[model samples]
Target: MAADGLDEIDYGILHLLQQNARSTTPVDMAEQLPVTDTTIRNRIDRLEEEGVIEGYVPIVNYEKAGFPIRLQFSCTAPTKKRHQVAGQALELPHVVKVDEMLSARENVQVLAVAKTTEEVNEITAGLDDLPLTIERESLLREERRRPFGHFGQHVVDD
Candidate 1:
């Protein structure tokens, strides 16, 4: 292990997994690293057990899936109750993601997807019921994500 606790092997596993978890195989990862396939599997198991490797989720294109309306709501909640408010926000039907921020104002960020304006209103109503102040709301145009860079060596495009 390196001084930071995770050595090159661990970081390689994380990088490959993050790149494409569904298509990644232990054998494929082992082929890239110096370890065997069994070692790759064992390392993945240990990472999961240690909570370093959390559950994987698919990135859905809501616009193509018929839920074209994507909304982002910035909200403010009592600092002491921010976590609970975020959890409650997640319970709403259209709400997909809730972020609890560490700040005085706009401490909560909510992302919701809906098929129509009514569903959006329903989400807004549900949030209104909570002890939060809706600061601003905007329609999301597009979003993109990539794996953490420091976790592994950067791969150049061909």
Candidate 2:
């Protein structure tokens, strides 16, 4: 949470934007917030500049958008080979994020942002070929979104 002038009203504005940034005009917000349009605009500007607000993004349902599969895999790789495996994983198709875990004992949970079920299977196959053990796997059949659930927003390039 940002401490700079971030009060309840600021949070409210953020909530509104999360659902849709262009939902309310400054004039519309002024009527409800008891603040001027300039105030709202200036605050938004400051939020963007301070890196509190990132960018507007259209929420797309992964399934509807042809990304019919979501897979989470936990596996283990050597500490020395962590960098090498991580680098290669990033280039694999349908991979979204690979995170290193300190408490994993000897495993890492990777949220593969795959485009399809086939892609997910292929990625898993490739990873399986290595000396890594797959601990857990999950298929994301839906794209979940809250009404206004953005704590922070940044540019998401599709």
Candidate 3:
């Protein structure tokens, strides 16, 4: 839905950052892209302004950062009330994020982080009596996303 000449450059930057988000700096990217530093800065600014690039978030080793186990709940709420229930479910303090996905090929899941089993239960408890039905509750001890370095190793690495 969005168009930009610098899309590939943006993707290249993101690809490099996927392995280590802090790996490259703007100046380095400017040099690598062979574009003026101002151009690089302006491109990043434009991406941010359009919300194409959200705020940079550090991927804390949540497991190492005191939350060893995480809970992911797959929910199936009534079609009409999905929005309302999703709002309430995500409002719980321990609830980190809630995703409402559609389509037959897709799956719905809620990821919650907790320091202990009690915290996980507390989060789940808060979801009780919601419009959604709990289809599955999967607990993952260690989880990670396969880094999608689309541009591969050509991008600079820190």
Clashes of 3: 1
**Candidate 2 lDDT by residue in tens digits, 1-158:** 35666765576567656656767777766665656789989978887997879987776566676766678787777777766776666666676778776653445667666665577679888778765677778776654557655532322211
What candidate 3 gets wrong by more than 4 Å, as runs, is 1-6, 104-107, 151-158
The whole-model lDDT of each prediction reads 0.90, 0.68, 0.69
Cα lDDT tens digits, model 3, 19-117, are 555766677776666466687678778878878678888766777877777788888877666767677878877777788777322134677889977
Model 2 TM-score relative to the real fold = 0.63
Give the lowest summed-lDDT range of ten residues in model 3. Answer: 149-158
- Model 1 CA deviation exceeding 4 Å by range: 154-158
Native-to-model Cα distance after best TM-score fit, residue 6 in candidate 2, in Å: 1.6
Spell out the clash pairs found in candidate 3. Answer: 77-132
Model 2 residue runs over 4 Å out of place are 1-5, 75-91, 97-109, 113-117, 125-134, 147-158
In model 2, the Cα lDDT at residue 34 comes to: 51
Q: How well is each residue in 76-125 modelled by candidate 1, as lDDT tens digits?
A: 99999999999999999989999999999999999999999999999999
Compared with the true structure, model 3 gives a TM-score of 0.78
